[model samples]
Target chain A: MRVASALLISAVASGCSGNQSALDPHGAPAIHMEHLIIGIVAICTVIWVVVMVMLGVALLRGPRAAADTAKSEAWLAMTVVAAVAATVIIIAGLTIASFYTTRDIGVPKSDALTITVRGQQWWWQVFYAGADATPGFQTANEIHIPIGTDVHLRLESADVIHSFWVPSLAGKQDLVPGRSNSMLLRAEKPGVYRGQCAEFCGLQHSHMAIMVVAEAPADYDRWAASQRGDATMPADPDAAAGRGAFLAKPCAACHTIRGTAANGTTGPDLTHIGSRLTIAAGLAETTRGSLAAWIADPQTLKPGNNMPMVPLTSAELQNISAYMESLK
Target chain B: MGAQNRLTERTIANPAPAFVAGALLLLIGVGALLGWLRQPRELRLDPPAVADLDQFRRMPNGISGTPPESYFALGKPYETDAYNLSQGKRLYTWFDCATCHGDGRGGAGPSFLDGWWLYGPEMVSIVASIRDGRPHGMPAFRSRMTIEQIWQLAGYVQTIGSYTPKIAAPSRNDNEHTRPAENRGPAIILFDEGPLGAHPDQGPSP
Candidate 1:
């Protein structure tokens, strides 16, 4: 009995230790799943041991005693039938229970915030629908949500199929091309949770990562408001020269900087580019050096990307990079 | 011995075995009931339609249709002379194709000097590619460069595309007559100051 107790304790300890990423073990859904699994396993283990012991005793005793063949046959038939029936009943019950649980946790419609997530080849474009229900602030790679609030995401794909998955917050749902799928997520605590593109799109797909920052309601509101506001271009002479180069070159042909005349929509908006955490759709760390390197040769860093290498002298490249960094 | 045998017979004749068998059967029935009770109840919000052969047959492949041929054939051909080829070489350096394609020998893309054509060996295909684009990651150059300049650039590319340098040994020159035009310098310069010529500020010179 002591050995059995020790074994049981060890088993549970190992199970608890094994799941490192299970932040919500005490949460209702996770707890329910764990309880069901443990119960089934325990019952099955007891049955197996009892049956094996009985079979061993029978074999050792031999057929010297009266056979009672008919009675034995009846028992065997009953066991087989009972096992099959039990299996079917268990499977059906589990399926039904899971379905109901999922339904009860269905997306909350009342006062739910709606955000549109568009997946491109190697990036995530996030758009928040404003309080008035108009198209609101747009950002990339990072998604901010208020803690303890239900947020609904309408997932869509711009070019190919991609999946939005932030394991700490909710389960994965695909963003299919030309169609929108909905998901509801609510985080209980304030922290940064990581997400990745679950679907294979193209080159740099593996590099696509997103950050979900769960913030206080006030902080989230401030961030959203700031993103919605116009971009501020620097008035310094070098920056002005850089701006000229940006407009004169092919930069304006693809990227859109909202308050300026650079309004080509082929690439992500760079109005608030200085505030973004990463560049090249989360492929590289957003810094002066990395950003300049990316601008100089995007294909070298992310092979098989749509952005071409624009010709720029070293000094001009520096000026343009500095100007972009000043936008925050 | 007679008494012992009678005792054993009496024990066997009693309801002991029957009681044990009945209890076992009852236990199994109870176990099965418990198992059934423990199973999860599936609540499907949307009940599935009854399975039918017709439903299976109606499924359609939802892939995108093939791209149009005109979309692929957007640019005209270019012709380059030796002087323009030299200038193009300098322009190519400024453009940074060498970073990925290597110094004349290709790395990420096929070598410019190699005759093997992944798309097409002809100058028209090259020009179209420079102007329109390829599927994987090639950006369309129509917005970036003029149509005529792209053609001339294609001509310069062709020159490099067909070139094979002569070996160090003079004996290799014996087959010079059989060598392709790409092996020699560019034939002619097909420069048209590119499409920007339409802009009064930066239009092509007469």
Candidate 2:
């Protein structure tokens, strides 16, 4: 009995709160959504109970006789009229509430911090626009924002359609090819909000996750300043040799490592790759081991992704992963 | 009430015919869905494309230099296959065709969007250009790519110059890309601005 009740309680509360659950609202837009959800569900529950009770009463009273009184018929007509009126009024109120909530989510102005997000096969390429004359920089799979600030995201796709949805921050918006779409992302508290590509975009879509890091203004500024600079030269001898190997191989032709000759644009820029929280769009945490594993065999870990396995010696692989980790 | 009760009793007594028919319909729908979903994410058009090379002869221009009329059909099988076209698109990126082509706009290399073919938009000609290399610094990719891969690239290249967008034309990344992104649009958004190589003996549009 104890085990069965424990299982039941866990199941019941599983979706009530979590990192990715819509029910756990942390931003203004989501709070509005939560309000609407609670209001609608509460109203519907009350109506359902009343309906069931009325149904039971009618069944208990039995079927009416063939010759009904005029007074009884009049009462039945009045009850139906009241029910129809109530339904229309309730639906109209809900519609009005929804309309206002959607419109009031956020209207981004030119002054808001603008970030351009490009959805690739199974990852996100994020570019942070510079403030004043600070100069912008790019990162993959991670976005950083200051709490209590309005973030304007210019969403675009590199290939197919993908939707950006962070249930804790904002509603879902699609990134369509050949055109640009915009969305407002904001947070009331400092925390990491998880997001993912909510569209069916080919084979590795399930692994296309992103994280929005909300921090204090001073912390965000410091982080952005560090990102704005080029990658630091590695102090370790192994990492320096790994850099030489990376530029010598085909990796240079597809990726760009700033302050170096690796200016290829076929893949994500690895300028500040070490600073990112996760690699391969949240496939794994950012670690030397995970980076080496991903580099050695991308097609196996995330099957059908565009990263083809380039044959690497164990030593070269080690040096490169170390070099990547040292970029921070 | 009595009539409705009798109707419910009749359905409960004879359920097999309706159930069997419903099951068969559901099975057929599932079978079709499975067929589509089973398309592997690997290259499937490469083998036959390699087989075509035995008869593959090419004259770059449509005149005496052009190959026989059968050469036109080399790109037919892949022209409308979305899967094959997308594969060719990927190869276009991996090979760094944009270094000179500039997203097929022809910066250092001749443009593919002008609808003006130095050689006509034949798969054979495109393959020859890729494998054997063309004039004015066009490097030969013969040593770099397989015959099958070359054909796939050729098919994608031919579509870049098409005036009417083929429904099967490959799609590209949606970004202000650093280099050649030929498949950026569903079809060629043509502009006659890229640098043209001096092909003094160019023929009319075929």
Candidate 3:
């Protein structure tokens, strides 16, 4: 019994707090949302308890005399009216609370940093708008934001509908095709908050995970500066051979590696793929082995996806994986 | 005892065997329909190259040779086949044709729904357009995709710009309701149930 109870407690406690749990909020918007959720739940619980108590009292005091029915009818009518009024008031209260919460969470400021996030079938294409002379560059899957700043996101979809949701940071906003939607996201704590496509977007939806890295302002600036530049030429001979292979194969037709002749728009931009925390939209941790495995057989890792299994020699595969890892 | 039995039987009507059989048949019908709707994944979904594919070798300026006349007409199942069209549709979205083409509406490229064929509405021209690419912004997909895959894409493209809606065209995506789906005919100004004169989706025979 004790062991079962301990296991149950651990299981319940596991979901109470995490990088992606709404219960443990780390941002102003999420904090507001959490408060609203808790408030509504408490209100509903109180109503349920009162209803159960009344039901218990009525059941316990069964078989009341018919003699006092005339007097009780008026009392019963008044009680029903009061109950109806209470229900209306409670519903109105919740509506107002949620309206205010949504307003507070979504209203974007004029000067908020605008980043256009386009949702493809299973990946995210992030384009940071240029500020002054600093030109904007494109990155895939990962979004980096400075802590304690409101960054406005312009959400759009490349194919089907996709929702952008980071439970630890802000509310969920959908990315619809042929239409533009915007959301303001601000993270108070500097941490990696994981997010996934809330909507079911075809076959690889579950593997379509994203990471929001909230860091110090200086650190964010440094990361952004690095991401904006072109991919450096491979210095090592193995990587050079890999680069040659990537260009010669169909990889050049789908993916774009900035600074190289590979300029294709079919797949994600791999200009800084090595710098990302995860590969294939958080399907696996970004490492040389995982990259090689993915390059070898993308169809197996995430089936029904666009990435075809390109035939490659074992040596060619090793060099290509190394070259991909060195893109950072 | 007989009177009592009659009274009980009269009070509650007993289910007829025909009714039970009809209900069972309905359930079976529903199960079959659902099974058909949710098409399960095939064992192999990747593009396996054809051994002999001498297509896309030479032309004036990237226009490949036309598919031979006796191709699918000779016992080969293609074009009108649902499986072939579905594979083509898969290649259509996955290869990012919708990126430049804007889901057949044509963003950077010409619109397929306009009924204006730049290189003629023939399947061979469409095949050449895809494999060899057009003169301007279009990119050749010879290296990336297989010949069968290209043919499938060409077949699907024909259905997109088709004057008459084909039975093999698949449904719309799982997202928000946009324009007329492949199954549905062209939409009106508001959307859906378009005018029947020129619209093939809701034609006179539909």
TM-score on alpha carbons, each prediction: 0.56, 0.72, 0.76
iRMSD per prediction, in order? 17.3, 5.7, 3.2
lDDT of 2 by residue, B84-115 (tens): 67767788877888888867767888777765
List, for all models, the DockQ compared with the true complex. Answer: 0.04, 0.10, 0.21
Worst 10 contiguous positions by lDDT, candidate 2 chain A: A303-312
Give native contacts recovered, as a fraction, per prediction: 0.08, 0.04, 0.21
Ranking by lDDT: 3, 2, 1
Candidate 2 residue runs with Cα over 4 Å from true position: A1-9, A66-68, B1-39, B43-85, B93-135, B139-206
- Ordered from best to worst DockQ, the candidate numbers read 3, 2, 1
Which portions of model 3 show Cα errors greater than 4 Å?
A1-13, A66-78, B1-24, B27-140, B144-148, B154-167, B170-206
Residues A169-241 of candidate 3: C-alpha lDDT, one tens digit per residue: 8889999999999998899979999988999989889999899999999999999999989999999898889
What DockQ class does candidate 3 belong to? Answer: incorrect
lDDT of 2 at A12: 84
RMSD (CA, Å), candidate 3 to true, equals: 7.8
- Which scores higher on lDDT, 1 or 3? 3
lDDT of 1 by residue, A122-161 (tens): 7888887777654476777888888888887899997679
Tell me what TM-score chain A of model 1 achieves.
0.80
